[model samples]
Target: MTALDVPGIRQVGADAFTWLSAHRDAFALGEDALTEDGHVDATWKPLGELAQTCASVCAVTTPADPLHAPAAALLDFAWLQTGRGELFPRLQRLEPFATYPLEVYSVFASAGLRHPGYEAAAATTARTRGWRSVEQDPTRRLGVLKAERRSGIRRPERAAPLLRRTWLGGLPEPWTFERSSGYALTHVVFHLTDWGRAPAGLPAGLAAYLTHWLPSWLDTCLDAGLWDLGCELVVVAASLPEPPDPALLRDVWPRIARAQLPSGALEQQAPQDGADTEPDFLRCYHSTLMAAFAAARTVTRLPGADGPGRPPAHDGRHRHRGPGEHSEHRERRERSGPSGPRGEGVPG
Candidate 1:
């Protein structure tokens, strides 16, 4: 099987943590300019590096396929656009970029790169930090703008309405209802459980939508406190050869939330809005993983599925022949094995 088909890749919990820790230096560009609130006041490095790091981590660890390219490109643009040229403004601007629920629009909003008015705030932040001049390459910035426009991905708008929708009862800003990082195998197990729990009667297109944006949204839920972080980690890490680790859950549970109503839940329950309700984290998680599962399978060579690079039968349990079918398959194998061409024959 290809790397894409190895369920372990989907469970990217520990691996993602390790990757991020290793690359912490790469992400440390404006650490000096960051405020207590998570903003970046400077632009010491190109934002592209952050995007590349996120994309590479996702691609190498997850079963992400064709969709990863565009996602990565979009993130790259967002990161660059948000980094103010000077150090101080960059710190104030970095909050949205560094925060959870990585929406496309928020990247711009966080960096004070969106609209004419935001420039004033960015400039003010920069000035406060005593960074008078910023020598940025306009072309590099333009490239990010161009890519974001081309991607056609919808970014979250930083309007009051969106904020109100996200606020879970005075919960902190940029709250993730859930958050997790680790191996891809954890993701697969979580995906299976999520799939099994899917409520009946979802439209056919739902799965497709979830796969493309699940990771970011899950980050949002974690940040928003809609779900417990330990639960997410547990769900993800469930796929290991051994049962899920109790110690892992115990360690993180204090930081994770208990089951609680999301801030948005009250709004849905309230009357007269007339807007289509946002789906809960459970639905979002399930939808994303299901789509990922389907996407991963698309790139894999499964048994009974014809392909140039089909997997050898002996490596995994999936290769086992069924009753009745085994007899004929064995007969064919025996006949073929005894007289097959030495070099051309399939391996025993």
Candidate 2:
């Protein structure tokens, strides 16, 4: 296994967050943000993503870490953008059945920001049949369940059944993995683990499966220049019960780091057909946010790293093993080698 390059990973995170902070205004919601016709994709999603990423960074890292303060500041800024949590209730009132308001607000709630009016309203809305029956993809349903948990709203559905419904939950054949499914798989892990703050939240079976295959998936993403998904995969690797092999991370992070523009933004997709055109903020925001998230999650897992509220270090108690698998089998696998050759036929 390659030696872990902690400094390199930190540098990638620092640059990405600095860029995000510098361009913070671009994440602001427009006048139409509260309107019926407002495009949630444009108006709310980016800001919500900012809050989520910032909150995750703050959750695992101490205020002393360079990444923590900016993330905290950004979280504050995002909360302020919601009119200090007032806008959420108004948005909820406007679209009572809409799930985005609760989903976005939950990130703030998890970060210690609260709005009584919004939570009260969401609680009532969640009890409605309309809200209860809202249809969503399995991955999205898991996200909503997680949001409800974070917001302290009561709901009857459990995550295990929902997990079984999603693509990753089934532990499907590795060859069947594709880009969209890859994102779905990563988000499932994020939701289950609370964005990497609690790796034990991941079931032993799932953790063992990922420990065996994540390297190949990560290599395929990096080889294809899928920076956004690649960063997400890195987060999944770090979130596993066992820390990822340092060699896998060391080999891929530099390629991801090189993809970042000097200004610190990372494009979701490199320009197609070899064009050199620069991507605007809309194209770069998510990948950059993810890069910061990936970095913050990873540093906490590295040996000798410290964070304010870092979870107890893995001590074998939480180490996941496949059914009937023993310590000797795991030891042999660890000693057997680095990851095998890259997976073939992986779609971008």
Residue 186 Cα positional deviation in candidate 2, in Å, after optimal superposition: 0.6
Local lDDT at 99 for model 1: 17
Q: Model 1 over residues 64-146: C-alpha lDDT tens digits?
A: 33333333333444344444323324434555222121222223332223333333443343333233232322222222322
Clashes of each: 48, 1
- Kindly list the per-residue Cα lDDT of model 2 for residues 203-296, writing each as its tens digit: 9999998887677777766667788888999999989988777666666677888888887888877776865455788888999999998988
User: What is the clash count of model 1?
Assistant: 48
So what's the TM-score on candidate 2? 0.87
For model 1, the stretches where C-alpha displacement exceeds 4 angstroms are: 1-64, 84-89, 92-231, 234-276, 279-348
Best by lDDT: 2
Q: CA lDDT of each candidate?
A: 0.29, 0.79
Worst 10 residues of 1 by lDDT: 339-348
